[model samples]
Target: MTPSVPSSSRRARRRTAAVGVLVAAAVTAAFALTLDDSAHRDDTPDPSAVVTGSAAPPPADDSLLALARRDPSDALAVGRADAPVVMIEYSDFQCPFCRQFAQNTEPELLRSYVDRGVLRIEWRNFPVFGEESEQAALAGWAAGQQGRFWEFHDVAYGEPRERNAGEFSEEKLTGMAREAGITDIGRFQADMASDKARSAVREDQEEGFRLGVTSTPAFLINGRPVLGAQPVATFTEAVETAAKAAKAAGR
Candidate 1:
């Protein structure tokens, strides 16, 4: 006859098993949720794929939704913190597709959803390009320290520039900060170089890596993974569907 396991030991083992299950699910979801390799490499590809989360309601304990911070004071976020739908954007500062989404689809979403308090948009700095990308991410966060993140974001994504070029040089970033209305240039520069800023950017980047994101402009809308710079209509439909689901479920 075998000895019975202690209750505490059994609970710990059960918890470990649960964590393992979630980890496996997240890894599988990441692969199933990413964009095509071609899209990541090019400026064009219609790059939209509605995966498992789109067609059906997400699980109540959606691991993807867990990624949403929903912090009201978050400078990189817009819309109501408790909005029925949340869109967590993972993007790189240097990616053309990211610029495409920012320039084209994002404005419309802001008008139709964010401004209307139906959706919340949280930004994740998932810089995958290289050193310049990292620097830009740090700059964006520094600007946010003074309530100028969106301003900086708009300026950075306003026009296309060659990747890894001098476009994101320190001097240029400082000029951009001034343009974005960050009053204290000294503080902004200091913040950009701070360990806090590096840690913040690193945290966002690691989150993206954990999700197996291999490209820019990825998103999780209400826990439904919508990869790449999808069309405005795709985002619109996703938001509307999520809002309706949230209401029906009394969320």
Candidate 2:
């Protein structure tokens, strides 16, 4: 060598090279894991895809199941208070996926599970689309005050419309209420603008946000997360599984 390298210097160089290799290996492994996760997510069915059929397994966090407010008298809910399964729905009035569930899968659940006392349905207004969506949610709550919430819900989701269009204007909402058999339009209007209605909507929105619900038509069946407007079979299976589990747990 041109100059004799100190032994300490040689050892330091070796250590530095070893550390660099370890760092590179760690980074490459981390990247591989990230890519694997992304691939899995990409393979999963898109929630907004046309709901011909799909079923996602329950999420690990069971906190979502606690969303069900099982008050028998709750106007925004239906089915037995002690039903084996409670299905809580987070929905937007202007969401087309919500409409798809309402028009297609919901009726089947009503017939098989709700009517059979195997399931309960609780509705939460989660209007993420904007002003019209919020207005429609408030209108729905107002209709519930007059015992016409379901009727209003049917009218609102009975057909599809352009998002944020004039479909949910104040005048149109009143007409829908009338169609839903709400005789007292005056009281409905008053309730729609009341602090109570706003508070109720805010509470539901907070709950959705807390649970990280970023989309409409999200669901919790006995605390199991069933996202999107999945098919009727998906609901049936969820309901059946939940019912069995509830029975096993003596719930």
Q: What does the lDDT come to for candidate 1?
A: 0.82
Model 2 residue 209 CA deviation in Å: 0.3
Per-residue lDDT of model 2, residues 14-130, tens digit only? 997897566444323322221122212232333455432133343323433545788878999989998989998989888877887898899999999899999999999999889
In candidate 2 the C-alpha lDDT for residue 236 amounts to 87
Question: What local distance difference test score does each model get?
Answer: 0.82, 0.78
Best by lDDT: 1
Off by over 4 Å in 1: 5-28, 31-39, 43-61
Task: Count steric clashes of candidate 1.
Answer: 0
Q: What is the TM-score of each candidate against the true structure?
A: 0.86, 0.78
Stretches of candidate 2 above 4 Å error? 1-64
TM-score of 2: 0.78
Candidate 1 lDDT over 80-142, as tens digits, reads: 999989998988888888888888899999999999999999999999889989999999999
Best by TM-score: 1
Cα RMSDs, all models: 3.7, 13.0
